[model samples]
Target: MNNEKVTVTLELNKDEARALAQFVKRTSHSDCEDKATSQNEAYLMMDGVNAVMKSLAEEGISPR
Candidate 1:
């Protein structure tokens, strides 16, 4: 297999999406520095992604 990176898309319901949005806002405000908006938004997005992955791992879940 090639070492190329692939993007993974997430599909969340309305409630889930809303919760993630809230989480991002909260985390970004507390964890991010006084940097550019783009950097802060990226940090928020990665926070959400890490949260989902961690949740799945805790539940012994797989993407298969």
Candidate 2:
């Protein structure tokens, strides 16, 4: 795998962000992992997703 990293910017409304967080939370690791990527990369991606969820909660945009 390439070690290069890229930045991604999204423009999601509060509800959309909340829904995305919930969806990521419900997704299984095996279901989300790609056949070409390493396990560590998948875990790191999950960690980044978790960070976004936490940030959304901090902004008071959590799911009911």
Candidate 3:
């Protein structure tokens, strides 16, 4: 696979930017600084949403 670099600009509040920087520092220690890192994070968030939805469904609550 060819490795090319892409640039993405994000506008974050000061607190959010600091949090993202801290997260990057922590995850980079585990060798997770790559394109797929954000994708993995997104999947993790989606999984949490799915779990919440499942619990709500069990309680007969509509999440519409």
Best by TM-score: 2
lDDT of 3 at 57: 45
lDDT of 1 by residue, 1-64 (tens): 2446556667776567566655643554335545436775666656555766565445444233
Clashing pairs in 3: none
Using TM-score as the measure, name the better of candidate 2 and candidate 3: 2
Candidate 1 local lDDT, residue 30: 36
lDDT of 3 by residue, 17-59 (tens): 4554444333431243242357666555454445444544454
Superposing every Cα of model 2 onto the true structure, what RMSD results? 3.5
Listed in order, each prediction's TM-score against the native is: 0.39, 0.61, 0.40
lDDT per model, in order?
A: 0.55, 0.71, 0.46
After TM-score superposition, the amount by which residue 39's alpha carbon in candidate 2 deviates from its true location, in angstroms, is: 0.8
RMSD of each: 10.8, 3.5, 16.2
Task: List the candidate 2 regions with Cα displacement exceeding 4 Å.
Answer: 1-11
The candidate, 1 or 3, that scores higher on lDDT is: 1
User: Where in model 3 is the C-alpha error above 4 Å?
Assistant: 1-37
